[model samples]
Target chain A: MTPEDMDLLAALGRTRAGLKVEADKHYVVESRLAPLARREGYPSIEALVAALRAKREERLIWAVVEALTVNDTAFFRDRATFAFLRETALPELSRRRKDGSVRIWSAACSTGQEIYSLAIAADEARNLEPGVRFEFFASDLSERCLEKAQSGLYTQFEVQRGLPIRLLIKHFENHDETWAISPRIRQAVRWRRINLMSDLSGMGAFDLVMLRNVLPGLDLSVRARLIENLAARLTEDGLLVLGEAESLAGVTEALHPVAGRPGVFARDPAYRAAAA
Target chain B: MKTCLVVDDSRVIRKVARRALEDIGFDIAEAADGMEALAWCRAAMPDAVLLDWNMPVMNGLEFLQRLRQEPGGDAPVVVFCTVENKVENIRLALDHGADEYIMKPFDGEIIAAKFAEAGLL
Candidate 1:
């Protein structure tokens, strides 16, 4: 593909999914989009881009964005994040609420492992405090991911990635070569297909919003907008969880990291005051 | 390097388990059946055991009961690798000192994951 084609693809990534496709990542664009182009009956990626530029097709544009977006995730991806959730977040949220209800949103929960992991943790938490009610909401940019997450079925290789054996045996039913998560765990989360770059005010506030490992690959402006969108959904005392390597520094002042906690964030006191 | 004793009646299963274990950095030792596995353990205890349920001369559960009685036998992480997918069978193995269980048709990834969960990896 030519420089203009690469630029168009990069622009689509940024505008649609907040992904930053640098010029150096031209090969990534080629390799990932190659199969998509072929599947969509285009002779080449250039042809696909030609069609994209000729007429702005929403379906084709989303297909390109989803193809480029990396959905590499596993159960309990960052141990410390879940440790904080179980040890600190759950107890504090349970105590702070008089109604004994807590709502959590797994923003950008790719393929459902993160949400299921959250469900498993929450289920375990309920044993300790029977009165506490946990509501799970998960959204991803890709319809493909949302469908797979909804199915709650995983291959042997998929299940092996970060899932504990005991939990696997407990929550998943083995069906020959595949494992399907129990209905109890599967039905716990409400799944939605949402592009975080768009307005998020329609989605109600969540006590914990998890947008892990998503921002690092996004363009600077997109990162700012996406973080603002996620933070807007957080209740006043709510926490935001990002990937371990991700930080709010220079991204947005809407949320600030909880002191000493690596990826945990809370609505900025200044941001909250301004909103108030 | 950690040592694992792969005890299965089928040589093919033993070979597969051996390659899988070795790939994940385990020094592998193989036995054709429970009796052979017991004899090997008596000489030198392995760090872990990939055990099969059914075999000639002795069975997995029987070997497990006997192994746990021997000195230093408790050191090995005995993981049952078998065609037995029944929950009752798994409970029986765990009740008889098996550390973890993997159903049949397992691959390197499954073994690695089970080993990781067992704290053997």
Candidate 2:
């Protein structure tokens, strides 16, 4: 790929999707966009990159990014992460809540798995304390994934990823070849398109925000900024969950690990005191 | 939007598959044999692949296995669109990572439904 193409692809990935496409991965980018170039009537990758640089076709630019956006997720992808939510995080948040309701946000909740996992956990949690309620907000950068998630449908491979057979039978109904999640579970959650790189203040405060399995791929500055931004929206007594491998250790001081839970975090008291 | 790469030794087969997929609004590409298909996939990963068996060069099973070894190999949804309908052949293709299988002499309707079943359409 030419230097110009690299720059254009890199810029588009960064600005539009929070994806940082390295020069080495140009093959991945080119292959993804080659079909786009053909469909859009650009003769070659060069022509496509040139057109993208010269003018911004909203649809074309988005097509490239969308193609590059890999909707890689499965239900309860990390057992420990969801286990934390079911056992410790949700219960602690429930006890502290003034209202019977608790709001949980699943940022970049790709294909609805992570958010739905939370909903299942919330459902299980509610059974123990009949009065407590759960409200969910799930958002992703890819509109395609959001659509799939909103449908609450999954293929066999998707359901087999980590969903226990019991929950699968109880919460989902088979439709042709796919499993459509039960309406009650679907109704408990809200879906939206939100690129984390942009403003997030519009989404109001939440008691638990599951931004798991997403940080390690990002640039250091981006990781820090995103963590800080998410922390800002947490209610004073809220929790922020990261992938097991992720951390706020060096990223930002706005959030810190809650003493006992491994991947769960809370706004640092010093930061909170200072903010107030 | 979804993308698909149709691979077959027969030009007519490739043509038909491409047309059928294009009508469904897929951005489609084609390769005549497994060797060319491997090159295409290594460069950029398609959302799905419609593959064929019994090619002169690397066969579909060979290509699928080799492709699985490449970086980002797990990304594509593969459907073995071939004449090999033997139980062993189907099992082998599925074991080799073919997401679905369709017999030859298929139409747009079959293509649409199979792809839909594979969660690609």
Candidate 3:
């Protein structure tokens, strides 16, 4: 891409959605926005870049951002993390909290798989606890992802990934072509649109926050703000779960990785915030 | 213990079905095709037969019909396990008197559920 094209795509990505595509990812940008350019009657990529630079079309700009957003997820995407939640976290939380209710938030639930996975775990845990209650809050910046998550329908191929056959029969209704999650599981989660770079007020506190597999791509400033906001919302005893590849050490001093728990972190009582 | 015959052209499927049935406390038997299964049934009756759709010499639907004709064969429960997952295929299998059906590539959990549904567990 020419200097103009690079500046245009980069600026559009940053301004519209706070996305930071590396300079070398022009190929990635070209592939994602190619169809959008064609739809807008641009003769080629060159023509589309020129159009974007000259006058921004609101819809066209959003399409580019949406296309670039990562929604690569599947049911029980990381079995180990879920196993930790099932085997260790839920039981410990149940013991600590006097109240029977537990609140959880999936900070970036792509299509609700992670939330539903948690539901399945919690439902199974009822065998031990008898009647513990669970409330879920799921959020994503993508409206399309939220809609799919709310509907709880998945194709055979989708169900085949990570979702076992036994769970499929128990938790979903099978149509000829697709499977719909049982109404109880589908209705259990509350969905909303939340851009991670945005503020965190008014959402209320959570006992367990699952912000898995989504931190690497963010700019440093956005990451710091989000961590501080998250740290403040998390209760003193609550756990903040990050992706397997993420670390809290350099990211923020307020949160520290809990001992022996691979991805689990908790508020650091001794942390002194950097002087502004 | 109740006896169950696992009928399939593939040895792997027969082994899998045998293991599943055995897990549920059924004495397991194996037959390679519908013809072999019929011959076995004439000799001795099983409590249930986990059957496959396409096999050499005789198919599963034919075996179910032929089994129904035999005096003691009709007593054994029949369940179809096949790649034909369409509703019409399932309806046809059930109409032909197979007690239940499970899709191919199933595990012991699926077998247990389908067996429970068929009242054979």
Candidate 4:
């Protein structure tokens, strides 16, 4: 393949694996990435792709992946999902847990929105269970996103999207015009860099997993592989949520759709039966 | 003032719904889940219910199904509050006896108009 063709394929490969890019929109990708290429001392996208393909340095490959992962997320991207989580999911999960602690994992959490939203959800759930112990794990593939997630700072526009005025007052302090997530909520979540393609055993099991808005990027094989990986970390009766647009259709046999909630599925009892 | 029950798991959404309804002279009651909503409805019948689709213990669909079976003087109008903007979900909500369907992150004026459409205003 030619240098340009290789660049296109690499971009396509990464984008399909949930690292974000509008590969079809070449000019837009080029414009957004030009500065990174310049900073990395590469003259063109072809040169950058060549360097990335050579894989001489792991850090360079990561930089390309980081650039490709679209971190375009708001405080609460989809309001209803969080609503369901706070009112229904957490409370129910809390009741089912033999231990007072509820474990929630925000898989592929980008820039802290999903995890922060979970913190807010957990706080809402706490209203029902005052002494509820929460173990929140927020993981992503990009170290850059993890740093931002760790910082817990958001722009005014970012805060305005799904954050309520009351939550703003209660959980965030104004850092000049930028809103900073409270230390309590920030501390509630433990952020880490985790590639979904790798082993997730060390993270332990979770009662609830928010895997929303991240999956459609993979091919059918990778999608199924990722779901199988995720399913292992979920408790037997645990809930697995996906983005409103994403689905488990043909992805994995381990999960079956929950009756009422679209894009939300649970471990298949039949699979459990077979395993048992 | 007309009483409206806002059933959602998210505090932010509940606050937003309450504020929107209150601005149009409606008293608001809040429920975080289906069981709480059903209990609240049994005790005090609100003029309307703003129900969310995907809640934890009892989701909106299950709540609607239960609410329909109960014997009450007058059943409150139920308008589904959701982010599932798909037409099929809306149709499902309506089929399950939801009077109307409203998408979330909506403007206050639109909420007020929904109340008016429901004749609660």
Candidate 5:
């Protein structure tokens, strides 16, 4: 890319809204965005950025954003986190809910891997408690990602990553080269296009909200805002999970880290007791 | 009895592999990590080594590299037992003097076949 393209990407990165595709990542950006640039009658990244700057069309801006969004997801990404969710969090939620219905939201759930894994956990939880009800809400900022998540089809390699064979056989069926999640597991989740930067009140309260592997790219203000926004939607006794590398330090005063579980925090119940 | 060194970080995987290898008449010597495996190899030369790719310290690839640098490097047939089944990983292991590669959650029959291929059977 030319100096102009580099400058454009750097500017986007400063906004902390873009992933900041660096000089080394130019090839990746070029490959992902080239087709869209070609279809728009732009011959190069320079022309594409010019059009994007002129506010020529919302579609072109969206195309740029979509191209920049890193959607590197696989089935059961981070097995230990899922294991904790299965062995500890879900059971705790089940016990706390008098109605026996547990709701979970996977914010920034790119390509639905995390949500689908939650579906597997929910299925297992339901088997343990026959009367337990579960609902999973999976949301992503990018419409393109939401589309992939809704489709719920993955390559054999994708499905095999971190997915045990027993869960694979139980929740997926082979469809030629791809493995599609079973309808029952698919039905358990509700997918929506949601911007983490926007208000989350309409999504309703949730027992658990997974914001894993996303905070590092965000600016401190945006990260704090996102946490506060999510905290409002968290059930009084809900759990908030960040990326393993992400921390709540200076992000929110309402959350206290849960010992032994990285990136996991519980709402301050004393505040609730005082309010009550 | 044929002796096999099982090198893995997970206790569950070690147990499973031990049962399979022992049932096929191989005596099992287990190591929790790659460094321990190397030490065990130096002390007692096993007929075969079942090596895991990822470990806390001294990963399998590094261990294999070091092992190949040692005297009688090619004496014991080394089978890479790992969760990472990428072709590149397999190629790297073979290039670094591994005899074979097996994906995780493997069956006893596959282990037997690998042992037979290594002339351990």
Candidate 6:
């Protein structure tokens, strides 16, 4: 790919998806977009970029943006996070809520694994507090990924990653070569096609918002804005879960890290009082 | 050096499983069928057993039953690695003392993940 092609694709990614394609990561862009260009019937990457620059076609443009976005995820990705949710987060939320209803949002839920994992956590939480009920809301930028997530069908290889054997047997129906998650688990969540760069006020507040592994790929300004939007959508006592390696050090102080938890954050009381 | 006895009538499957199990730091042993697996267990109990559902002479379920009756047979973690995908088959294996069930066409990653879940890794 030419330098000009790289710049155009980078600009397209940033403007459309809030993704920041680093100058050094040109290979990542090329590797991901090469197949896309071929499938789109373009002779070369340069031809595809030229076509993109010529006119703004919504379908093709969004296709390029979605391809650039990283969608790597697995079931119960970090076991410790779910353990903390089961042992501490769910119990505490159950204690505080008098109506016995807790709402969760899986922001940037790629291929539905994370959301289903959250569903499993909620399903098992009945053992802790029988009165507590969880409502799930999940969203993604990619329509294709969302479709796969909606299907709840996973290949043998996909099911092997980070999924415990017991949960696999319990929650999924085994087919010849694929596993489909039970309808009870799939229907528990409300799915939407959302762009975090835009306004989020229409969506209701959540008790727990999981924006894991998303911020790292976004530009700096977009990350802060996304965090602010996420913070606004969280209830006063709601929690926000980020990726393990992610931090809010230079990001907005709308939320503060919950003590003793690496990735989990709580709505900052100070920020809330000031906003009030 | 935890030992795992891979029991399958098919030598190809046994070899594939041996390579995968060895890659994850397990001492490997191969058995032709359930009877040989039972004999191997009678002499020395392995840390785990990767058993196939169907085989000549003695099948996986039969071997599991007989192994459980042996003096120290209940020690090994028996994981049924077979083409059996039916829920009834899975329930049967679990009911007959199998610890976990993995469908066929598995790889090293699956073995590692399952072993880790079973606390053998």
Best DockQ goes to which candidate? 6
Give TM-score, chain B, model 5.
Answer: 0.95
Candidate 6 DockQ category?
acceptable
Candidate 4 lDDT over residue span B2-120, tens digit each: 88899999999999888988889888999999999999988988889999999999999999999888777247988788876554565677778887666665768557655555556
Report i-RMS for every model: 2.9, 11.2, 6.8, 13.5, 10.6, 1.8
Query: How does model 6 fare in lDDT?
Result: 0.86
Indicate whether candidate 3 or candidate 5 has the larger lDDT: 3
For model 4, what is the alpha-carbon lDDT of residue B12? 94
TM-score for each of the candidates: 0.85, 0.64, 0.67, 0.64, 0.66, 0.89
Q: Model 6, B17-73: lDDT tens per residue?
A: 999999999999899999999989988999999999999999999999999999988
The candidate that wins on TM-score is 6
User: Tens-digit lDDT track for model 3 on B5-116?
Assistant: 8999999998888888899999998999999999989999998999999999999999999999999877998989887766567678877888877777788866876676
Model 6, A35-154: lDDT tens per residue? 889999999877888888887788999999998999999887777788778767876777767557889999999899999998888777754556667888899999989999999999
lDDT of 5 by residue, A181-202 (tens): 8988888889887767666788
Residue pairs of candidate 4 with colliding backbone atoms: A16-A217, A87-B9, A88-B56, A89-B56
| Cα lDDT, model 1, residue A70 | 79
True contacts kept of each: 0.25, 0.00, 0.04, 0.00, 0.00, 0.50
Docking class of 5: incorrect
Measured against the native two-chain assembly using Cα atoms, what DockQ does each of the candidate structures obtain, in the order listed?
A: 0.31, 0.02, 0.07, 0.03, 0.05, 0.46
lDDT of prediction 3:
0.78
Candidate 1 chain B weakest ten by summed lDDT:
B83-92
What is the DockQ ranking, best to worst? 6, 1, 3, 5, 4, 2
Worst 10 residues of 1 chain A by lDDT: A267-276
Worst 10 residues of 5 chain A by lDDT: A267-276
Instruction: Name the lDDT value of residue B105 in candidate 3.
Output: 76
- Candidate 5: stretches off by over 4 Å: A2-4, A7-32, A38-41, A126-128, A269-276, B1-121
lDDT by residue (A55-110, candidate 1, tens digit) is: 79899999999988878899988766787787767777777664678999998988
Residue A266, model 1, lDDT: 84
